[model samples]
Target: MRTLRRSTRGRIGRIDSRDAKTGIGAAELPALAGGRIERVSVAREQDSVASRFAERIREEEELRLSPLAARSYPAVRVRPEEDCALRTPFQRDRDRIVHCKAFRRLTHKTQVFVAPRGDHYRTRLTHTLEVTTISRTVARALALNEDLVEAIGLGHDLGHPPFGHIGEEVLDSCLKERFGEDFRHYEQSLRIVDELERDGMGLNLTEPVRDGIVRHSSRAPLPETLEGRIVRVIDRVAYINHDIDDAVRAGLLREEELPREPIEVLGSSGSARIDSLVHDMVEHSATAGDIVQGPRAGPAMAALRDFMFEHVYLGPAVRAEHAKISSVIRRLFEHYVEHPEQLPRDLAGGDGTAAEDVASRVTDYLAGMTDRYCIRRYTELQVPQAFAR
Candidate 1:
């Protein structure tokens, strides 16, 4: 139990928790004894176990005064708190998501294509995978917390409605009218993971992850650390390029129609374009004086984003379908509100129905939809399905 002085992570020494910094949960959360540790890994680890795990003291002298360098919040109180064999924060997050019902439901959620489409057409599951990879890589490169970024990536879309953004917008509108409160997917994702996941067990994810999920909208959070910023940027990069590909497949827009800037600066295809954009953002952010460049990239990227918004997002083909989908969800909300018996066994006799019946039913039903199910429900309500499930 000799104290070692080193420049690496996971080192044992007398460090104030207020000034404590360890690598995000690649190894394990530093024990909360507030004194010393045996073997810990910095979120930044080198190759050697003894050196990487070799104790480094983060005494107050080495600590940075900035908010970005602050220690992570204490881990959530999950089960099996043996004190000795505790899970790493990342492992806990992984387990929490696996056990949650919402994570399971992602299999049927839309990424762009509907259910039962070609297996490769990015279900919400595949989309999460892509985001996770992109987020992790960026975090690692930035020397940011990979565990927090990974957790955020996994939990980002947890609140997406049954048919993806289409379903989310429909539900938001339907619920807003009933309750006079908007139901954003970002907020809903947080609410679902916080209030509805695991029979209301909630994911109880870390603060950093929750912030990413809550602020994964057009208005990105002023991140406390680089990891969060990476997640936010990678998210936009992943969605825009993937959406373009999806639109191309759906014949909503041709690849040739993409704006010249993003195409020329990035590339013309899906993967290439994503890589290019990610690199540009990362490189720009990593450079001295340009590290964040957050507000700076706005003008150039905003114009391209607007072009996509005009040419691809609101294009006749997609909105035409949105109208049909919206009508379907709206009708279902009306039906289930009047007749609560049709709702699942779990939702009856709750405060949700008592206060806002229509919004509650819409939330309940929409939360369970597969891509095809949303479509089928729409058909059933409007045209009467010949073979109803």
Candidate 2:
């Protein structure tokens, strides 16, 4: 067997004298035996880079964070099996979320418009990215744990169903009617990382990350961390602006038709509105020692949100399509409830004794579907096609 030697200056001395004749001196030879000089140099450079990155994380924790910032040291949930020398706990959470299957599914899920044909319309994935960008800006300004805020923002909508809020509403009503339970995307998002991801092995995320994902929705309870609170407010800031942009693009609403009072306070354009909200949040939150918006900007933002709900979200322009999608969701749920065996083995009850388990399994499977997949499956099951068509 060949002996393995680590790269070192001393090892270069072992090069053959013939190497000297080739204008390769001992000092110029590769330090690692049986490896190219470039390989050894690259390996050393990678090691140095990794070391500097780890050191930078530590220094950032010490020098950059404020007293109110959540520290990555002493993580709330320690997983000895998944510890990383190069990344802090929150950073690891962010990485895991970005790599998960659920996160990928967000690309195909509806954001506002159902199965919108326009390439520019925001999907669930784009919406999550916007939330993350806005949240990080606020987090960094406050000297908070941006990694934690990013993980939460990236994961906040991981459990959203295929047809936007209409899909969610259908699922909620179906669950309540069939099983005396409710379906909330926030709770489902928590369920995903904790139990459903990684083929049931789960992401095993830290407590703060999990808390932020479950509490990012305004309807949910406020999260315990400042990072979580930052994401919570930023979620509103992101969706309100982007949904308006999407509505205008869809020809459902005109930019000029937007309510004037809120526009005067927030800003005329989407970018200006986002800038105003973020700046106001940072200024107010820094002064208050907590995440908040200025007195003026807060109410103005709320009015903008209310305007979107009335004119775009619940508008007549999309009502017919929304009802059709809601009907599809209802029909799909009923079919699964009647035929649990059609579900994947992991989701279908093996013994079929517990109705609740069957309902839950069906719900899990349905919630994870993408918009196209849901529609395709609905067509296959509900619509009968003529032979050889």
Backbone clashes in candidate 1 total 6
Model 1 alpha-carbon miss at residue 355, Å: 2.1
Question: Over the stretch 3-38, how does candidate 1's per-residue lDDT look in tens digits?
Answer: 233334434444332423543332445543456664
lDDT (C-alpha) at residue 100 in model 2: 98
Model 2 per-residue lDDT tens digits across residues 312-385: 77888767688798878888899988888788876423436378887888889889999989988888887676
The residue ranges of model 1 lying beyond 4 angstroms of the native Cα positions read 1-73, 76-86, 113-117, 220-223, 287-300, 348-353, 376-389
The 10-residue segment of model 1 with minimum total lDDT is 52-61
Please provide the root mean square deviation of candidate 1 (C-alpha atoms, Å).
10.3
List the candidates' TM-scores in order: 0.73, 0.86
